[model samples]
Target: MSATGHDYAITRTLDAPVEKVWAAWTDTESYGRWASAEEVVLDVRPGGAWSSVMVIPGGARIPLTGSYTEVVPNERLVMGMNVPGRDEPVLMALDLTPDGDRTKITLSQTFDRAEDRDQSEQGSNMLLDGLTRFLAAA
Candidate 1:
């Protein structure tokens, strides 16, 4: 939870080393391998921009764009992302912790409206689950 009234968090564990998990996030090519099936164009530096088009199960493509707010090598990442046509962009933070052979990943997203926050919470959790599976296979 954030100081802002509209925020949500999701924590997940990956049965992989922290460095390997981090690479799945920081490496643009690796990120694309799991972030979406279509393609992911990521410039993963502070202030760098990133975008992805996810080919959903029904074959619909949903595009998302964001700018990196912070990029801490293997520890964390924060970004401000917006879905086109949406009113407010969300602030998303990904925190990683190493625990022996496993890694704990926490994802937090804050929105401006309560409704949006709720929706994002559910959606992000699904995405995180997908990420977890992706990393495990990598």
Candidate 2:
């Protein structure tokens, strides 16, 4: 998919079929494995709720809550994430497209400030890296 004027966009190609990639993304058990979350609760449907306690570096646990604004099975997912101390929720869109035997994934996040976009890039990359490893193992 093309850019959607999101503040931050990260693209990755996973060495897995579109079906496997989509399952890893939408399934709470698979997602928690890739995300390294302490806990995860995902209701994968439009208007559903999702939350995760991410265990970042130094053993710090960051709680993130979000609601799904859109869900289109293996094609697309849009969620609004509520992070602590943030006045507005960050909107994130996950798009998946099949590329032969593999899958191309785009993660686009919309933030209100440029600093927020810049600050999130590293963490996003780390998450993608984790996902790649997770898929490789699977």
Candidate 3:
């Protein structure tokens, strides 16, 4: 759980090693492959930029922009996403722990509104599913 009020928190263990999971989160191509987003542009260092243009199944498009607020190599990441009409940025933190050969990932997201937080939780699940599939195929 985050220090702030985190509306969504997910803990998942991936079969892959910490190195692979960390690469997936930090590398643009790997991230794009499993992020359920298109045209992803990632600059992974602290204070760097990240953005993704999402394309829905029905042809709807949503663009997301954000920056990496903090980076701790393979262990953790802190970031915030920018929403057009929102006053405050949606914050997210990801922590990775190596468990044997697998990696345990905990994700926390804080949203200003409950509704938005609920919606984002579903998307977060989908993103984790995508990452699972991506690892399976590897």
> Which residue pairs does candidate 3 place in steric collision?
none
Model 1 bad stretches (over 4 Å): 1-3, 85-88
Tens digits of per-residue lDDT for model 1 on 46-88?
9898888877657888887888989997789998887777775
Report the lDDT tens digits of candidate 2 across residue range 1-138. Answer: 225332878998989988898899888899999998967999989889999998987999989898999998889989889878978677888899999889999988766666777778778888889999999998
Position 7, candidate 2: lDDT: 81
How far is each candidate from the true structure, as Cα RMSD in Å? 2.1, 2.8, 2.0
For residue 78, give model 1's deviation from the true position in Å: 0.4
Candidate 3 lDDT, tens digit per residue, 31-138? 888876788888889889999887656888889999998899889999888888877667789999999999999988876567878888888788889999999898
Q: What is the lDDT of residue 90 in candidate 2?
A: 78
TM-score of each: 0.86, 0.90, 0.91
Off by over 4 Å in 2: 1-6, 85-87
Clashes of each: 0, 0, 0
